[model samples]
Target: MNLAENTLANADFMIEEIKKKLRMATGSALKATKLNDEQYEDLKDIYEMVAGKTQFSISEIEAITTELGRLRKA
Candidate 1:
């Protein structure tokens, strides 16, 4: 009920909201992309690389996206 407690609670609520929005957006993006099974793991790896400390350039992103386009379902 104190100031710090209230601030932490608000931050937690905001983070949960952010997580929900992120999931929704990501799901929509995946559906739109229509990624194949082979691309699923590649996309997850790319997501982790982007989320983590790895800094990717616009060219790298373009290359990854292009690679995903090349994947076809068996």
Candidate 2:
């Protein structure tokens, strides 16, 4: 997937990757459809940050998840 393009497929890819990297227990709740075009860049930024790291502290995971929550569509 060419994530450089801001498409929904790319967004879905990033969201799934982020969930795996973070080992999010509630990942199912964070669906790609919940992400909108307005939040794509923010999600991309989060995805990049998560991708660059191999491990995360509980606090870091919480913070990242919280940020994602803020970006989710209501």
Candidate 3:
């Protein structure tokens, strides 16, 4: 293959590898987590507010619950 073709193939491989790693990380995070009702409610509220208004990240929701829980105990 030519240099350009080889470079494109390498980029595609890297992209697929990144996507696989992300999927594994997300699945691991979900498997390791257990959210209480309050956290679920908070997540629900967040989901509603940003349902179509913005892009949602699971880690952000996790961070919100973690921060809120810490705040409540302080």
lDDT tens digits, residues 1-74, model 3? 23123243433333333335334343223210344445444434433343334443788656544543442343
lDDT of 2 by residue, 1-74 (tens): 77878787888889889988887767776667667666888889999999999999999998998988888644
TM-score of every model versus the real structure: 0.37, 0.86, 0.31
State, as a TM-score between 0 and 1, how close model 3 is to the true structure.
0.31
Clashing residue pairs in all predictions, respectively, total 0, 0, 0
Top TM-score prediction, candidate number: 2
- Which is the winner by lDDT between candidate 2 and candidate 3? 2
lDDT value for model 2? 0.84
Candidate 2 ranges with C-alpha deviation above 4 Å:
none
Model 3 lowest lDDT segment of ten = 24-33
**lDDT per model vs. reference:** 0.42, 0.84, 0.39
